[model samples]
Target chain A: MITFENIDVVYPNGFKGLSNVNLQINKGEFVAIVGLSGAGKSTLIRTVNGLVPFTSGTLTVGDVVVDPRSKAKLRRLRSRVGMIFQSFNLVTRVSVLNNVLVGRSADTPTWRSLLGWYRAEDKELAFQSLERVGIVDKAYMRAASLSGGQQQRVAIARVLAQDPEVILADEPVASLDPPTAHKVMRDLRRIQQELGITTIVNMHHLDLARSYADRVIGMRAGEVVFDGPVEEATDEVIEQVYQRSLTAEDIVTAEATQE
Target chain B: MVTTSTAERRAAPQAATVRPEPPRPSGLVYLGLAGLAVLAFIVFWVIQESGDVLLIPLGFVTLWAPLNPVIGLVVMLVALAVCFKARIGTMAAFGALAFIMMSYWAGATVGFTLLEIPERWSNVEPRLMAFLDPNWSYIWTVRDQWLITISMAVVATLVGCAIGLVLAMYASPVSSPNKGTSQTIKAVNSVIRSIPDVGWALLFVAFIGGTAHGLGPMAGILALLMFNIGIVAKLTSETIDAVNPGPVEAADASGATLTQRNRLAILPQVLPGFVSYGLYVFELNIRASAALGIVGVGGIGSAMMLQLNRFQFENVAAILIALIVVVLLVDMFSMYIRRKLL
Candidate 1:
């Protein structure tokens, strides 16, 4: 389980990223977070991995506490909660298999990782993760050579290899095209179903969230305005959460909706 | 399932392609050519003179004269060719003519005859034996001094690179702990870098208040350290600044410690450059060690200088041969390492 209790994040320059936000997500649940730009969706997802620390909050992932004050504790917390980015931040100079193997550093000894000595089991696990993402044949190729959607899949393979309990994907498909975006969303859904990982995705597209998420959490100006199952998340609720009427740009499949 | 469209393949009629002609040189280029022609004619006239009016500027010209009419005719023909070409070759020919003029005025001459040898070769027999004799028995004369010179360079380069690497990390804004630390390191390095290697050597020799030959290799090594630190730190920090930050972020997100992040991400990217820099510093140190001997920091240079001062040309010759052999060996070794790095 992942829990955020009365979390508030205020930057040193006095910008509030999150304010009095509380959320509880059960294991194996798929939740989509929707918000306009600067509405704290990214801050909410990053808080789980302790990538962005909450100023006043108690965040617990499994049994580990997310405490930025203690680096050892923060590292332990990060190991169990994987975060993905819109840019698919893999080291493009390295091979795809080597990019996946970076996940093993959390488990490998410091000396071993420094010397790039991976155990046979870790190598086997990396190959299996690549196979799961259906990019096993491209594992030896450089990550920069892969297409955008393929690179995102390699990133998903990295997360799977880490075997995290809660997967935080912040705008995973925001950079992809319409058809490739649908395919990547299906891959994320399949991975979630097969491994029973708690997956939280921060998405801007309403139709994508409606199609993929079991539950939707809406935010406006650093506070959650709506929280319920997909069926209860009506168009009126989304418009209220964004504090404006929805436009065609707010939906990825707007053409289909218009027809 | 054969889907053939209504598109048909056709060939267009062929015609000759015409390329545009290149632009011609402007009148200004021809003007420059005329100026060069005037300069060459003046130089030819100067070369045929009887005295040293242009000797200093045209030192190479005085060796031969345009005394013969045939030679004068040949020079005029060359000048005419340069006038038409009006290019870099024309400018070069003008320079050659100037040198010929100077040489002719200087009354210079070419010689192939050997000069007489000094009878003091027997007095410089010990230095001669050192080179020709396989046993190198004369090495005992300056055994400790030579060792000090070699060790000073080796140790200084090794420790200097280490210190430089640390300073570079702090000097780089990206990897530094804070902005203040980065600026301070850069400031300190800039101050140290402004001092020349020989200047550092001279300062240390004076500050210690000892004979130039007796203060030990510490003075020389210290000078080398000062020089090496500036070079290595500047090169390394520039390289560190250029590394991709994406991998560093990935390492952080993957729960890597600071050391692990550097080792796995930044180190691999900069290791080759750092090795190349280290080898280059080593070569600089070797050459600088010889130079530091002038200030009496205990190197082969001091020994050779001492031999030359007493008018012992034979001894000086032996020392020069030894220095050349040592420098050649070091250069070859450094070249091999650089090739391997590539």
Candidate 2:
């Protein structure tokens, strides 16, 4: 379980990223946070793993109080929580297997990781992760050689190799085309269902969120405006969350058709 | 109303056709021309009086004659005409004129004269003939010294590249643990790179007591090693700084420590660049070690200097050919490795 109690994040530059936010996420729940640009969706999700530390208030992830000040605590927390980025973030010069093996870095010995001597079990895990993502054939190829969609799948394999309990995806499909976006979303959804990992994704595509999320959290201007099941998040609630009426641009399917 | 306006426009063109005035050179151009003329007069006065002319040593060569003023006058006039006629920008025309004048001034200061080469040819005829008939047997004598030089280059380049790779990691802004560490490493690297290879060799030779003390190769090795470290660290750090930050962020987010992050995310990206620089430094070390012997550090260069002192031009020529062949072979080998790696 993850809980945030009156969390506030004020950047060093004095920009308020999140203000007095309270949230409770249960285990095995797939939640999608939706907002317009600068609506604090990414900031809210990043706080779970302490990537963006909350200036005040207490955060609890899996029964441990999240403390950004303690390096050991933060590392332990981050080890159990996997984060994905808009960019695939794989080292393009290395083989896909090597990139996936990086997910095992926290568990491997420092000397072993430095020397690139992975244990046999860890290598097997990496190959299994790649198999899960259906990119096993490209495991030895450089990450730069893959297409965008293939690279995203490789990123998913990397996360799977980490074996985290909670997966936080920040705009995972924002850089992909519509069809590829849906495929990646489907992969995330399938993995969430199969492994029962608590997955929270930040996205701008309302249709993808509504289609995949069991619960939807709407954020606007550093505040959570809406939180409920997908059925209750109607157009009116979404418009209120966005502070504007929806357009074709807000829906991935609609925008894809216009193109 | 449109028809009437069209008729008026047609009649307006027939009234008068005045051509616009052609653009004239700016005042800055004339000022630059006047400055060049003044500089020319100073040059002429210096050449005539032969005063305040710095004669830089060009080995056995000397100045042949004073520059002719008529040639200088013709070149200046032609430059001034082009500046005015081309109507280029003031800055560009001034820059061109200033560059030409600076070249002439530098040449005159250095006492550069093409005619001196032919005039002194007779003096070099004996050496040329001796060089053409090189003593092939001299190679057996200096073969060990040549080996020492090549070995010094190989060891220095390899060991220096290893240390340099680590220092480069600490020096780069992206891979460094903190800003203070990065800046300190960069400052030290700059200090090391500022001194030339020969200067380092001389310092070591002075401290270690030269070849007579049986430590000449050690001095040469130390000098080349320092030079290699300076060059490789600076270049590899620049490559490290330009690596993709995305993988670094990913590693951090995966809970990897600093060392782990650098090893997994940073090293692979810069490995090719580091190896390429290592090979290049090896090539440079080969050539540099050949000259360190002049400062009393033992190598093929010391042997060559000894031959030159004893007036054995033929043996010097033989050693030169061998050095050239070895350098060419190393160059080819390095290029092949770089092509395969990159």
Candidate 3:
């Protein structure tokens, strides 16, 4: 379980990144967060592992309270809370298998890793994770050599190898084409379900979010305006959150433009 | 696939709509500033030549008569500016510097140059001809010294690279985990870099005695190591910090340890950079070793010092050839390794 108690984030310039936010998420829930760009969606999710520190709040992940994270605690929290990026951050010069193995580092000794000598079982686990994401064949190939979709799958496999308890994906499919984006989101949702990890993903396309999310949380200007199950998330509620009524014509226009 | 160019360029029209961002001055601004520099140079030259601007022919055509060195530079600059669109002005400035340096050397060497050693040959030490006659067989015989010098260069490089690697690893913000700790590492590495190798050898010589003389190679090695260590550590740590945070975050999410994260995420990313840095240090070490001969540090350079001291220009020429060969060889090796690594 993860809990945020009245969390507030104030930047040095006095901009409120997140304002008195409170939320809780349970494991196995595939939550999709929808918001306009610069709507504190990224800030809210990054606070779970203290990637962006919350100025005031009791942000707790299982047993860890993410306030003033000491180096040791931050590492411990970071180890369990995996975050994905739109950029698919794999080391370009290295093999996919080695990139996946990096998800296993906190479990090994420094010297061992330095020598490129990973543990036997960890190696096996990395390969299995690669297989799960269907990029197993590309394991020996350099990360830079893969196609965008394949690299995204490798990223997903890296997270699987991490064996994370919580996964936060920031605009995970933004860089992908619609079809590739759909497949990537589906793969992520399926993996999250299978692993039973709590997953919160930021998404732009409404249809993709509706199909993948167990619960939809909507935000605007650093405030959560709507939170409910997909069935209860009316277009009216989306209008209330977005301050723009998204009609069927709007959807058609969006689809047409995307084409 | 979205093929609509209009949609792809949705934000393109906004460039004109938005409040125009103030454009910074461009290369023309630099060109205007360069005019100031030229004015300054002219003022200095006027003062230097006692207002005799005609003696220093202001243009390219007549400057090389007794060559007002700066005039040659100005000519070169004009030629380069025409050929390379002003890019060569900078090169011309440096060229002028080189010209001044050669002039200085010419002044220093006048007495020595004037001492015309007899062109006649000696049976024991034949006349210094460009040809390596029976008299110059000693250059070939000095192969053992050449090997020893080159070997010393290699040893110095290895030691410096090792220390640099270790310091870099610990001081790296990613591995150290504490900002304060990493800062201290940066500071210590800086101090190590600031201390010169000759100074290090001199200090160590007082403590170690006789260990200092003919120890130019060791001195060169230590110096190369110290300087390279500072560079390598800073570079490697930055490289470590830059290793994409995605893999690290994944490792962390998996409940991995600090050791695990670095091992899994950081090391692989930095390996190529490490090898590249190693090669860079090797090239630096070869060049640096040549200077260690004054303090009796081993290497072909030490022999050059001895020859120069004895005023045996032929022997000095022999040592110079050996040193140049070693340096060039090191350069080739560094290039090959860097090419392969990158």
Give the top-scoring candidate (DockQ): 2
Error of 2 at B142 (Å): 2.5
Over the full model, what C-alpha lDDT does candidate 1 score relative to the true structure? 0.78
**DockQ of each candidate, alpha-carbon based:** 0.38, 0.69, 0.37
Best-fitting candidate, scored by lDDT: 2
lDDT of 2 by residue, A44-137 (tens): 9888888788999999999899998887788778888888889999999889999999998889889999899999999999999999989999
Alpha-carbon shift of residue B268 in model 2 (angstroms) = 0.5
Kindly report which residue pairs in candidate 1 clash with one another.
B58-B102, B58-B103, B59-B103, B61-B99, B61-B100, B61-B103, B61-B104, B62-B103, B62-B104
Candidate number that wins on DockQ, 1 or 2:
2
User: Pairing residues by index, what is the TM-score of model 2?
Assistant: 0.86
Model 2 share of native interface contacts: 0.69
Q: B1-342 in candidate 2: lDDT tens per residue?
A: 545676788888776887676678787757767577667866666665353332445789864433444345566667767877877666767677677676766776676667577669999899999999999999888889988998999899999999999999999999998999999999999999999999999999999878989998999999999999999999999999999898898888888888999999999999999999998998898788778888888889899989989999999999988888888998999899989988
Candidate 2 positional error at A178, Å? 2.6
lDDT of 2: 0.88
- For model 1, residues A51-124, the per-residue Cα lDDT tens digits are 78899978888776688778788777777777778989887766899888887778878888777888999999
lDDT of predicted model 3: 0.71
- CA deviation > 4 Å runs, candidate 3: A245-259, B1-136, B169-176, B210-220, B234-263
TM-score of each: 0.63, 0.86, 0.75
Per-residue lDDT of B1-342 in model 1, one digit per residue for the tens? 475444521222224455555444454655664565456456655554343231122665555443433343455446545544554444455565555444433532331112213446676577565445333333456666567767877888899998998898889886776799999999999999999898888888777732444674777888889999999999999999999886766667777776666666677667778888888888788778777777766676677567657755555566555567766887789789878865
How would you order the candidates by TM-score, starting with the best?
2, 3, 1
Give the number of colliding residue pairs in candidate 2: 0
